[model samples]
Target: MQTALNNPAIIRFLKSKFKSAGFIDGLKIRYRSLICPFISLIKMVQPGDSVGDVGCGSGQFMLLVSEFATPSYVYGIEISERLVKNANELFSTLPRG
Candidate 1:
């Protein structure tokens, strides 16, 4: 977060993520269809399979996949720089792709 102290976009995005109730609500709505199917699909995929997780905020799911049976490489795409930073903090060694 210190790295993002000077970035308005990251600061604003993080502020909104924390200040607004709509963030989590909207996340649930956005992931309504994708959440389960993705886990199932990732389970089916063998090791080394390249999977892209779109809008991978904070990447808990990606970390879960990595911890679970998904030996395949997981890629995380996050539009918000705040999420990118948080995700990196949580899983520093995990590559974005």
Candidate 2:
């Protein structure tokens, strides 16, 4: 399947979501997405699944879950206030279903 990492539009959108992030942080997000097996992780989510993620930095995994799955609920916990804030901002941009 064509994951977000393979899709330019998705990658662009992800990067754009981090516009307020520092340059190094944005780069780190991009790099993490490329290396993580997000596709496999996404595939594990079934429709109506209530997903939870630990250490979900910037909510990237949760973001992909929103994109690729019809989960009833998604939650993410990150220690960094900055990352959690960024995750909230990014999620706010997603269209409500």
Candidate 3:
């Protein structure tokens, strides 16, 4: 996972801590826009569905899906090291089951 933090230049830009509030709010709205479809597809996501999210900026959607769905594993490939670090930190603090 640490290998995700290798792009020093790109990481610097993404690490500037721009207001994620707007981004966060927009994310919720985007989910709302597609909730109906997502609900319909819920049954299609098998236990081992390898859902790959390309251009997954901050990985918020992956976390959201995990709350309701269980697969063999959830693997996200992100290009931004800054977001990777942030995700790592957030998940690290999650209580282990």
Candidate 4:
């Protein structure tokens, strides 16, 4: 499945999220978004699949999966409590479609 990351609107929204997050978090987000192969991962998913991401950091990968894939469910596991909270906050903002 082709990720809509190429969509200008999605790129702008992701950039806005990065900007709103502070510098360190923004850098981490950028690394996760660009350096990590979330798009490639998305390609591997089939509709109705359930995905679990270990060391999911701030859940950016899972968020992208939720946005771009037809996965039945997405789960993210992170060690840091703060990151978990942040991830939950991020998830809350996303619409359940």
Q: Specify the highest-TM-score model's number.
A: 4
Ten-residue region with minimum lDDT total, candidate 1: 1-10
lDDT of 2 by residue, 8-93 (tens): 54567567666676888777656765676766787788888999999988787788788767788998999999989978887886
Q: Sort by TM-score, best first: what order? A: 4, 2, 1, 3
Per-residue lDDT over 33-88 for candidate 1, one digit per residue giving the tens place of the 0 to 100 score: 34355445545757776766799997765655565444557768999999999778
Which lDDT value does model 2 have at 70?
79
Clashing pairs in 4: none
State the C-alpha lDDT per candidate. 0.58, 0.76, 0.49, 0.74
Order of quality (lDDT): 2, 4, 1, 3
- The C-alpha local distance difference test score for the whole of candidate 3 amounts to 0.49
lDDT of 3 by residue, 32-92 (tens): 4244344444345566676655665566545444443554555567789998886666456
In model 1, which runs have C-alpha deviations exceeding 4 angstroms?
1-39, 93-97
Clash pairs for candidate 3 = none
Deviation in angstroms for 89 in model 4?
Answer: 0.7
Which is superior by TM-score, 3 or 4? 4
Write down the TM-score of every candidate.
0.52, 0.71, 0.50, 0.75
* Per-residue lDDT of model 4, residues 1-97, tens digit only: 4456544434555676667777876666556455656667777989999999999877877877777778888889989999899889888877664
If both were scored by lDDT, which would come out higher, candidate 1 or candidate 4?
4
In candidate 2, how many Å is residue 79 off?
2.5
